[model samples]
Target: MIKRAIALAAVLAALLTAFAVPAQAASGRYFYGVHAGLAGVRDYHGYVPSTYRPGTPMPLLVALHGCTENSFGFDLLTGFSALAEERGFIVVFPDQSTLANPAQCWNWPLPTNQHRGLGEPSLIAGITQKVRSQYTVDSARIYATGISAGAVMSGILGVTYPDVFAAVAMGAGCEYQCDILAQRDPDEQGRAGWREMGSRARSVPVLVFQGSADPVVPPATAGRVIEQWAQTDDLALDGADDGDIDAVAESVVRGSVPGGRTYTHSVYSGPGQGSVLELYMIDGAGHSYPGGCSCSLYGDPSGPDASGITWDFFLAHPRR
Candidate 1:
């Protein structure tokens, strides 16, 4: 068992390579439509920035909206449209249907929907692949990020479809488990459902954002996500027996975002010092995307911009 674990870790570690982040968005065309998938249909709206050239491949970022929120509403709430227009990347917003959930939420908190090639994960992955095949996209530079329930779905994408995303950023989200958001399993294996879903992307990089004062989804919920990824990074690097960050952590960076949140940034190095897990604990913010607009529907505008922060993180990590 130990030998097999060591061999698998080495092979996965070798898969990480330096990636070049693209600049400038396309001026070609923007479209909104519905995609038919095995699970169901998903509505998506995308923007091709003005900075884009005709033939150059651009990075793709899939931004998911929270419950009761539509794609256009989330674009306003997070100012992602404005960022994409300036930063030069393709941004896709996938909307959840009321039929899936009465609140229009991604069914990520359910065990049935948590695995790969099934439920909402399959639908979203199909959309990502469709976008990649349609436009000039950097296949290795694809990424995902979301707020609240959307944030939870982003975690699911990172775990279940790492092959589709380079990395995932989650804000005020919980782990990829069934009912754990409202109920705790309390078992080691049960709590680590993230590891069980898929091992192909077991050590895929993760960026977490949690509001210290979030009212809707507290930092405790985000803590579970950070802890899960941190432990998975440990098991991948040195096996389950030595899964402890305090001892294996390569470095810890701590500071504040001007006058807003005093944040702690922890990085766990995988096989080649490739940073695999990161946590940003935002101080004094509500259940909204940090550094976002005063849109009120999704996040607090007085803080640092989550869009800019996420783009920077995604730029540094890519699937090999």
Candidate 2:
């Protein structure tokens, strides 16, 4: 009778443990209405590591989605939330107002949107402030990353809110807006725009990733952006060199910046960062996250893993 009682107690304990473990692992999702323009836009987000508790400060990463894309799509495609789990960071995805643009693209270039006090930049800043108030977030460690249109917006955010974001990573996007201007020649206006954009965030470090074969945004544009940032930092140019060209068939060019870091221009090697700018050029790859699902119009699985590489870069540099 004594043995049976002991066995029954053990069984009950095992059952309780099984139930409690899953309950502890469950994650919660939250939604809030953010005021953008005259109407309030609903922003949906999921905070991961489900184990996060109050008073625990964690690094925050704001992941923006591309045109015609939503938060759920970006979360599924990049799987960055998984990185948050391992790194113990809070990841937020802010949805673009589709009412403004049917495709839900970020307004990165419009003069009205580019200003510090209004438009998309303000909306994103508001989101960050809201999250900071609700959670214990490290202000100095705040970062932003995105895809395509969202990537362009990330650059915009870095420039407009340099005091807010510590670092930024852009995939398949350029430093300046690619739109054509009416008063200026296409080529001349493009160059001037890049220089102006570079001037805004002269001190902020940036990581840029582009596909060599990307049809949407040319690979050369990525190189130009890196050069602009390097020049802004007054870094010595190291010229071009081959990077991961054999196995992955990538090439790179490196330059030294004022700090102990070097600016790198890669054309196929795994993702890496230099001083103020780092470019990852995927050889034979198109405008998609490498090693991820080939769901987009331009996606290649044979290139370097961008999600992992970008996260690593962000971890190395915190806001100084």
Candidate 3:
């Protein structure tokens, strides 16, 4: 009887091991928890590279997920956690609850969610702050990136919390106040974004990625995001609406993945320093995360490596 009982215990342990969650890898620490802040309660997942030390400050990145997505799935879709381990940065993925939006989308279009210290933006920022409290984060090197609705919220973060995020990256997303700007042009949208920034306004560097063949988010919307950010930076530079920050591409480099979609890389110079905006237009690609894991529905492995490009951009543009 004793032998039989021990054998059953061993079988149970094997079953538990088989069903256990997989770790990020042997090289990094991956964790998840809930953060209750002034805005509300938010669930989040995080990854810290093995290279991180107790006293050393590491760059922090907040990655938001799109509709029908959650923090864990986004982490797998973009492969940002692996990238973080390789690059020695900390990454946080904030989950959107179904209760907030039935589709599990970030409320980027609503007025309440578009401003500073309000709604989803505040909740996301609160999550970021919470991560900071628990980790050694470099204040000036903090960055934000997202896809679809998540991408729109990333832009709103740049507008509403300019002091917190040093740079922004959008994937298959439109400009700030995109829903309301349907009748307006990119220039008008830029003005609205600048106004949204208010006194905390600064020229936040932005990187954009889009699929020319994307049926969900048309290429034009991505183009609007590029132009709108340029206009906002123009205004932020000298408090004037003048187009000092040229939206025109300083250089256009065309490339193609081995057997995948061809792409155009455009660089737009900023008002004061280096390129403020970089646009990657992937031809023939659909609405998906470029160069993401094939395991996810939104992942497009054959496209350009957006995650790598985003990290490089963030590293290049620390807050002054």
Task: Predict model 2's lDDT versus the native.
Answer: 0.64
Higher TM-score: candidate 1 or 2? 1
After superposing all C-alphas onto the true structure, candidate 3 shows an RMSD in angstroms of: 5.7
Q: Which candidate would rank higher by lDDT, 1 or 3?
A: 3
| TM-score comparison, 2 vs 3, better candidate | 3
For model 1, the run of ten residues with the poorest summed lDDT: 16-25
Once model 1 is optimally superposed onto the true structure by TM-score, how far is the C-alpha of residue 80 displaced, in angstroms?
Answer: 1.8
At residue 127, give the lDDT of candidate 2: 84
Error of 2 at 188 (Å): 9.4
Instruction: Report the lDDT of model 2 for residue 134.
Output: 83
What is the C-alpha lDDT profile of model 2 across 65-156, one tens digit per residue? 88877765676567666667656788888877667788888877677666565777778888888888888898888999998888888877
Cα lDDT tens digits, model 3, 1-320, are 99999899669645532322235544778777787766668888788899999789999999999999877778878878888988889999998877778899998878898789889899999989988999989999999999999999999999999999999999999998895446787888798888988887889999999999998998888778988999998898889877778689888999988987799999999655878899999998898999987878899999999999999999999987
Clashing pairs in 2: 243-251, 244-250, 245-250, 250-268, 251-267
Q: Estimate each model's TM-score.
A: 0.82, 0.71, 0.91
lDDT by residue (tens digit), candidate 1, 28-102: 345676889788998887777877675798999999989887666677677666677787888888889878888
lDDT of each model, Cα atoms only? Answer: 0.72, 0.64, 0.87
Better of 1 and 2 by lDDT: 1
Global Cα RMSD, each model: 12.7, 12.9, 5.7
